[model samples]
Target: MSLKQSPCKDEIIAEAKRLGFYKIGFAKVRSVEKASASQYADWISVGCHGEMSYLDRYHDVRNNPQQLLPSAKTIIVCAASYYPAKKQSIELPQIATYALGRDYHEVLRERLMLLADFVGGETRVCVDTAPLRERYWAVQAGVGFVGRNSQLIIPDAGSYFFLGEILTSIEFPADTPLTQSCLECGRCVDSCPGNAIIGNGAIDARRCLSYLTIEYKGDFPEGFSLGNRLYGCDECQAVCPHNSTPIFTSIPDFEPSDELLSLDKKTISELTPELFSMIFRHSAIKRTKLMGLLRNLKALD
Candidate 1:
């Protein structure tokens, strides 16, 4: 049965706020062929995707939301702030701030599912797991502007957040896109230790520390040192001027666990598969698996 369309955009936004999402917006599910795709294609063509073969699996579906859900009328884009004011101890083997808490995939998927249930229609919740171009959807939905570093930078909230989406047959109003672009501010580009940020909105994921530390399964590239990173690297985001002023997150689910924040090299090196599962069973770190994590630790040494 075709569901009758209603203007529930305001309600959806309100519920999103009540659910603790920092921001919510909407956009029409349409074909996108921006430079983003071309750049991604170039990256994939050169094998920059490394061992992440899933990225190459759904090229058409990932590029176009309509392909994922033909009947989908709107895309609900949401961002949840994961920023922590206090930095983790440098002596510890660092995990990304996003992984310090409950797995964002689980936390965000649950919230997005509730939204879908509230709307009551054919809908799907997509966190980081999906093939969708999440940042593009977020910008199209008017949640924030893509910065020079290619991270979505909200005016008030900065880039220390996660983006998620819900594709549904319901249409909603979208917010206005940000008018001010990064004014040739090369802070992020200049600050990138791995020199990943090439230019405005361009990133060589192959050289990106985050990609190397978390996504790549093999040994670290020649001359590239993992240092203290045990999970994901946030050096680029940490150095962005927009992210300079620490944004405190109120979501308890996002708070870093004491064990996660205090994990030392000794702990990580000695972590068995069973211990790894026990500690990160509810965290996104599980994505790397025990062997993958050990591989990352070895790179750091």
Candidate 2:
């Protein structure tokens, strides 16, 4: 049904803000067009996905929302700022800002469920863990523009945010997709220490530090070191000029716990599986598992 027949768009946006999302937008569910489809195929063909075989799973659904859920009529895209008010100690083992707090999969999933309830319709939520191309939908929803770094850069909040989506049978008013493009500023390309980010809005995931820390399971590639990162890396975001004025999150759940922010190499090195489980029980770091963390820490040395 059309949004006019259901909840008003303004009310939906207001509920999103009240639910702690930084921004929200809607888009019609459709297939990935020629440009996007070709780019995705090229990225995968070059083996940039690394050992993440799942990226190839559900080929149809990954490229088309209709294939994911046939009744899906619209995509409700949401963003949550994870920029921390305080930076972690330089000497401490580093975790990506997104993982400093509770797992976003949990936080966003719960919030999306609430949003679905508010909209009162058949709905499904897809966090990063899903096979869907979230940034593509975010762009279609007019929530943000893709940056040269291949990140969804929301106008005011920069790229330091997590994106989530709700696939529902109800359609909503959609904003005109943003026309802004990166200033042809090659800053992200020059700043990538691993030479991961390629041309504008394209990334070689195999060379990305974030992927290396979180998804790569075996030994570090020759000449590649973890630097100070132990779980996930944020060097690209750290250097982005757009992220200079960091947006602080007021959501209590997004705040980094003191223990996690203060974890030292000694503490991380001494961690057993059980200890790791306890420490990251509710954190996204669990995606890498204890062994992955240990592998990352050893690479740093």
Candidate 3:
């Protein structure tokens, strides 16, 4: 398929909404903006990425979308709220809202593939793991601004959303980047139990509770407390005043499960490998694996 001269922005956005995406934006595929690239290099150089060596391993491909899709000409970014209307027990082991239901990678990928088909083009799909700096392009696409806590904060949607993109060969006029930024509320900073927010939208993943819970492959590092979190952490987003009126997701795939909302220390401690595999079969919590969840539970205990 060849690039069309007309802007399909409205049509594409309409389809995305029909598909349940809450936010949508577009950007021409090109090298990542120099400022974002530089900041990433600095973050990695200072070892802020911690054991997530994959962030450094794919530096070139991540900086330039052309490397991932040689024929790609545009990026269609979309985000969906995962915030649930119901809250889990305060005393139970807490899980991130994003992980409460079906795995976003599965849910978002299916929707993105449908969106890609709607665009009628040669394309590639990306979720969180795909080496692409999604939040960076998401900002360029005008979906939202990078908050001080390093989350892509969409207006009204808050930061409790999942982002996915379809890299397409079809070209479209790029959306103007958003001029808005957070009010520098410092609430997220003051609220962080791990002090992971190192300011200026940068995070020391080594100290990030979310990173430590789900991404770190080893035991909890010395001096880091797991608190009550068993899978991922949402302290930064939870404290943001913008999230006070969080728009709950209508997507049933993002709803929390009964087991997740009722998970207590005893339940978690009793999880065997077999039961863990069965219960978390399609949950993002599977990313932590049984061992990692057990590790976090033990640390919190």
Best by lDDT: 3
Report the lDDT tens digits of candidate 1 across residue range 211-287.
77777777655665677777887777777777767567767888877887778778888988889899999998888
Relative to the true structure, how large is the alpha-carbon lDDT of every model?
A: 0.80, 0.83, 0.87
Q: Estimate each model's TM-score.
A: 0.91, 0.95, 0.95
lDDT per residue as tens, model 2, 221-255? 66668788887777777777778787777567888
Ranking by TM-score: 3, 2, 1
* RMSD to native, candidate 3: 2.0
After superposition, the stretches of candidate 2 with alpha carbons farther than 4 Å from their true spots are 1-5, 221-223
- Report residue 9 deviation for candidate 1 (angstroms): 1.3
Once superposed on the true structure, which residue ranges of model 3 sit more than 4 Å away at CA?
Answer: 1-7, 221-224
lDDT of 1: 0.80
lDDT of 2 at 237: 74
